[model samples]
Target chain A: MRKRWVIGILAALMVLLSFKKERLFTEPSGWPEAVYDFKRNPPDPAKIEIGRLLFYDPVLSRDSTISCGSCHLQYTAFAHVDHRLSHGISDRIGTRNAPALVNLAWARDFMWDGAVNHLDVQALAPIANPDEMDESIAHVVAKLQKTERYPALFYAAYGDSAIKTEYVLKSLSQFMLTFVSANSRYDRVKKGLDTFTAKEAKGYALFRTHCSSCHTEPLFTNQRYEYNGLPIDDSLQDWGRMRITRRSADSLRFKVPTLRNIEFSYPYMHDGRFKSLHQVLNHYASGIQQAPALPPSLQKGIPLSGSDKAELVAFLLTLTDREFLYNNAFSFRGR
Target chain B: MRFFLLYLLFSGVIAARCQEVNVRVTASFSGKPLLLESFYQLPGGDSIAFDGVRFYISDIALYLGDKRVYTEKDSYHLVDVSDEVTTHFRVSATQHFDKIVFHLGIDSATSTSGALGGDLDPGKGMFWTWQSGYINCKIEGRSNRCPTRHHDFSLHLGGYSGADLAIQEIALPVSPGDIVINLPLDKFLAAIDLRRQHTVMSPGPGAVALSKTLAALFEVSR
Candidate 1:
């Protein structure tokens, strides 16, 4: 009896330790509390697997030719490259660039205009957009119910075979919440595990002086709307946040995107007008369109010489996390 | 014998306190029951037919004059015109309430609470996909005066922010037993010109105006 009791306690301890080892999401050493309320929809391994499968599944679209992964690829830090604007169903072009899906667990709001208020409902925007998936949440649930694999997968995650809108959305969030990108070289340097070169150090100083106000560090975004002084595109005529708020004061403002993985996630800005980092830096230095909405920091413009631009680019490269880009866990494994 | 008599009395009091009341909601046009897809003559001489009519009724409570009495728990009912089962629900309330109070739409706190199940689910087609907010009241129909495609007029009224908060609270005096609430479609149609204002697919000043108009049409018949 004594031996049995000792063995039982050891087994319980082992199970507890293994459960801790298998946690999917862990906040980095010095990060603020995540805005996403995890207590409502805690991460489950089975649910994360379902979310990963759904992310790559084209059945979420009206036609089976598009998926969330089509616009958000894992290699380019989960952002679309090669296209200036987002390409959706039937080769339809979207007005805004497909923003990177990085460190989304920390985001208070989604989209360039802050239209989507929560991450749980964020997938609904692309699914229902005429230019994108063009599918309704109800229809998507029906499609998932009819699928051979989805019912079983949902059952595994939710303990029921009936696929529901809540289950589908919550599961997708579970997968995306695992997309924490805090393992970059800059993060390592911050931890004193690595050191920046002289040029990178100069660029870091420049970034701190000029860009840190809006693209605040750690998560790399202050998560606020700002007019970055880009001239209005006559063709698109997109009013950004003003369209959502219906206020003239918010006319040219867009959500400040994170600069993490800026090396790969280019064709930048809300409209994706700047093709390269040099063009973006040059625009900050010289190409700012004069406007009353322009932020006071960029009222004059960033003063960067040709060499300073190169140094800034070097610092930006340090923001890229190769482990996050190449993580096999995020990649599609075919059924 | 005395102990048994007291036990019986206590059980009777418990049963009376937990008594359930049924609330039935019905839609009508000019004092007649309105049927979906059936043409009705508008006061303005234009014909109208409803394809769908649905709205959320939430935060139901009972009162004695201005004093609070009882409030329903988890009180959200999606009254869809096509589904008679959704039009009525039971609420637990004791006798002696002079007034009934309820909101015509979901409260702002519940709207932003993120993904929910049951009647508030996104699968219900009452949630806007492009923006995050429950469509508190949706009325999709066709009118001869409407100049748009298929002569259709779709009004999805909902907003949970500063100027756009569209939920309307309605209080009605009642004597109590079972209650029946009637929504007159004629009053709703009389307030709007379908030719000029056909579509209100999103929340704004237009939706807020329509919500108020719709809220005023609800009446309780004892």
Candidate 2:
């Protein structure tokens, strides 16, 4: 009789646990809290579905041929893999690469140069660019409002029958904010659920010594712009941050990218100049360009030996979250 | 075809309302027409014709027959000035036509926030990506003065902090008889000169001057 009472109480506790709301965004253990405030537009299933539909819809483009997914593919963890620079409608080439869209809720700014400060407005950059989507927000809003389906969808999520830019953008951001990649092998090791191999442990130590200042641990990015001794390309002559500041000191200072999935997010950096991880390590080891403005860490070379490079590469591969990459929740589906 | 007909119908409705108010703004010149890459200079030059001109206006409140009818939220607008299209406005529902209030460009909060679309997109070449601020106002055109060829000029003017704050609110009343409510090229360029200050691109005293010039033009006629 006593055993039956205990069993009944335990089942009741299980029922209670199942009813708890699953967090829309969660901080992985041992990681810094996410930078995005989910409270602004809380996670709702309907809103995320609407955002997903818009993300895959080519109607946002001028010629109706390209969508955000055109450049950012789900197969490549929402990154453009075939080419370095992004291609827009009519095969129009852009100046920068379409970066991977993982863990973006933690990002403070958007674009390689950190030009866009707010996440809600990031979609507008590609939508309005003459060489990108080439459509105005007003024009896009009008287009969506004219559509018979979109108004109802917007109405379902937002209490208004009229679809506006804020709801469209904010909902899209909600879906993007849902992309969290914190279940990697590295994370497991941090959680003590698993142990790193001898090579991975050694590699992690080398990474800590050489890469952690800029590409910090846990989340794997300090989120600050830095100049890692890269020579200016003659054709583009792109001065990364100088144009924003008008101060010569900020010239060529591009935003430091996260190395969370560095094994797959290759052809790295703002320009996509390097094609392989071996080449990236080589640049850090010995090819660091000398400049008055280079970051302090690369003032001298990273000075890694050939074996050390191999081990560092091995450890970076540990950062790849296969489950996150293959997750069906982020896959593209025709709405 | 039907949309065009409706638009035409609405245009006349707006015109009649403006006529009831009888407000007019002059197309005067303080120096020369607001030149590209430069500021106001002495007048008496060749005709200043513009190819493309665009700016924004916000906070539109309309009055009807003795009562306030409609008003817009923030009410920002991008006014494209060329030879073809001119004179646009909203109609009031009420009978009392008395006053209107508005501002040019983005408000203070909208200006400071980062990475926005619409009138604030960087691709428009209006906002500076590196500096993390909007150009606020952009006016550029060819100049036939003692400068460079084509006299390339840009007005990348905007600021949010310090003494260089760009946002300002202005209110003007509706006057009587055939209002016209013309934001003509002449009225906007009254304080500008092509020869001396042909190109005033980017922020400084040049943008503030243009803003002040825009404020005085909203004169209420007796």
Candidate 3:
């Protein structure tokens, strides 16, 4: 019995010591542990600052005309506003909308089609896409290596003057991983520090009943694909998840995006079809097109009264964490 | 005195069990030495000049008869026809190994484990930027039969999913001492219907099918 007790105490001590280790991000109360393996890529303030510099620099693009910050701006919750589809270098139009970069540490896959399985490698897609940056990682590495500023920054972060692909990508992920948006009004309400208004409370109830299945709470996403009854665009016949899986059953299924900061990250959906929450609610209420792959819950259009729609919109607005949207720390650092 | 005797006996056994074994892989086209940037005739009577031929082989295991003898940890290798330095492995010796088993492509774990260095580095031209995964094998050349610009035929085979998994496990017989595994490119070229589909630069059913065919193109000799 004494030996067993000693072993138990040792195990408990180990668990405590592990918790005391440096975390990539703080786990918000009642939130699930982030999917990102913090143990491998531990967060460091120096690396985060370096990533911040890279995020805003247009040098990552082929012609030095566009940067990651071109689409992902801070005030707009890191989503490109005023464009249905994201605009890239040389006035090139991309096929899909750039989703908001909020709570990315909890994401299992990146992109609307779930192409990038790991966050560390996700930047490769945009950096190489012809419509986007149109620059290869090798070229980007060479560019960073040649830069007078980046070499020292990389050395400070990684203790090496030689800038490599792993350092570049991990640093970008490190910065993106720090974007935690858990201080919204809903969070405060959940913590009993504040209370929701009657309309927001009603909206919350309606959201739990209808929308919470796919857009689960806390993270506001179940991190899975679903056919949400949006008709295929005429010009761009993007068979969403099927493009990745090549399965007929997965056709038209796109990843369920987080509802956090929905108010600012406008022109919503994979293609940014609905520009407002009212239009989205209307689409859910009466605009669902009948399809074989459509989720059963969304097949029979959700019946929502005008008042319920208003209430649901109010609740969605509560998710807009102003602290996150206007966080000066995420803004562009002048080179 | 007895303890010292046992310790000496065990020390001798340990030393015997941990000798260094070397494995070398060599690439060829139609049983002839594969020379980069040299022209070679295909089965379809078309002369093909190769510019590059690189591929990854990982997860090496040695078997003595039916029982497992040795398995290398973190065993990923990039075999480029031009770069002879990468086609060698120095592993701890086993009691005996009659057969050597290895995958033709990187396993899913290493492929999805984010950015890597050395042979698997993206800068090495074996990685796809649009999609995150290592190109298991890359065969680029200018063929007379190719109808496209510059008559180039670039085939990059890699994927990591059901029905699209590109990694193929292959086992070949081996004897003691320095081992050389021959990968005859003609065997892979024999199965390719280059006329119909030659330029495969992305992951899909075509890449997966080609990876399986390439996996069978290896032969081990003493």
Candidate 4:
């Protein structure tokens, strides 16, 4: 028993050494503690590179027609611009708009109705959705394994070259998670290196009063599902949050969108109903739809005037995130 | 003097680590060898055999008295059910354990951030894309009640936040020499009365209900 005890102690030290794996991510100073707890499974550079390759690869879709980047373009904060709703493989139109994939680590929930709860698995929905990538996970894994490029890439990223479902999804998630939208002009201003112009600052004040309650600052979202007062369109009739919960009370409670990088993340709202900030401001000012799920803050329909609208638009533009848009580090590699 | 004491301590640690014992952990669903169909009983008894089933067992630990022995390097295994008859797990640890504890899924840190490859890779069907989360539990099988005509059910169950959390802890014994803990199929009966339902494929109240039963299989005996 004593000998066994000594052996036990030594074995534990080995595990301690193994578990002492290096942390691949750092909580950038002044940023909130990440919603993703990297301590349990640390991020590795190898995995991130693999994820980047997959992100740009079209192998994730059926018929080899679409990649995740198809709808989530980098120039537009990963939000699609060609259509009001997302268009996927075989030209299938989805019911809801594809929200910009920005600063997702800070998000509380995912999807218009918050159907998904974790970031690693979010890709499964689009990959498997018939109206989207239209590909099955098993089929995709086989396809990836057969691809000459993927095997080499997987070997470089992960020591073993075997292409399985878990590695593919995790690698893609690594790339998406690193697509952090933290380098905007607003970020610089927040860091105290710069100041907002008069129009921008004035607009900022109006934003704080009229919209900050839901589309909060910094991260620019509370990350809760809220009824933003969007009236249901007769043609699409997308019910937003109600579809997930089957609760009448949640008839239209869509996940609150981040106002960060709003300038580039337009046509706003769940359905991409508005093409410009002015229209969004107009809806906020007086076009709120009345319903039980209408957020308590917007029930009064923000009482801003024409000048206020102009000021709000200027403030929204401050969130353009120029560095995020043009950052060469995030650009297509070997393109 | 400090260096001398440190050398003595380090030597003892290395010596202890050199000694090891092997333990086997076999877990199956119901009384039968686990087929994806018999296991995942979702809402409304729509039972179906799945195309696949995958899960991870992490943080296997050994406790001898107050001290704990850990699996240093590769302590996780993604059990694939394709050709293997039993989900056989033979672990060699550098510790004499009086007890053992492990997790049924990869811990929280690995589920988010950075990219992962191999068993933890996202390309694996176990991960979710729309919600950007890992599906720690995957069960696909045939069921009559499924809306998909194949009579097939794909239940990807795992969520960390809110009420949908599925991670659970299991504790067992290391046995003085060789210890084998069996997570038999009957535990499914312990967890659910399959007569009521056979299908649960998404994240909600149903997944949590089933995972509770799954966590009850750990035993601390030698």
What lDDT does the true structure give each of the candidates? 0.90, 0.70, 0.87, 0.71
Ranking by TM-score: 1, 3, 2, 4
What fraction of correct interface contacts does each candidate retain? 0.83, 0.15, 0.72, 0.52
List the candidate 3 regions with Cα displacement exceeding 4 Å: A1-24, B1-18
Looking at model 4 chain B, report the run of 10 residues with the lowest lDDT sum: B188-197
Writing each residue's lDDT as its tens digit, candidate 3 over A111-159 gives: 9989887898898899889999999989999999999999998998899
Tens digits of lDDT, candidate 4, A185-228: 66778899889988888888888877888887667888888887
lDDT of 2 by residue, A111-162 (tens): 8777676777788788888778988766777788998899998898988877
* DockQ, candidate 3, vs. native dimer: 0.72
Best by DockQ: 1
Interface RMSD of each: 0.8, 5.3, 1.2, 4.4
> What's the CA error at residue A61 for candidate 3, in Å?
1.2
Best by lDDT: 1
Error of 1 at B28 (Å): 1.1
The RMSD of every model to the true structure, in order and in angstroms, is 3.2, 10.4, 3.3, 9.0
In candidate 3, chain A reaches a TM of: 0.94
Candidate 2 chain A lDDT trough over 10 residues, lowest sum: A17-26
Question: Model 1 off-target regions past 4 Å?
Answer: A1-22
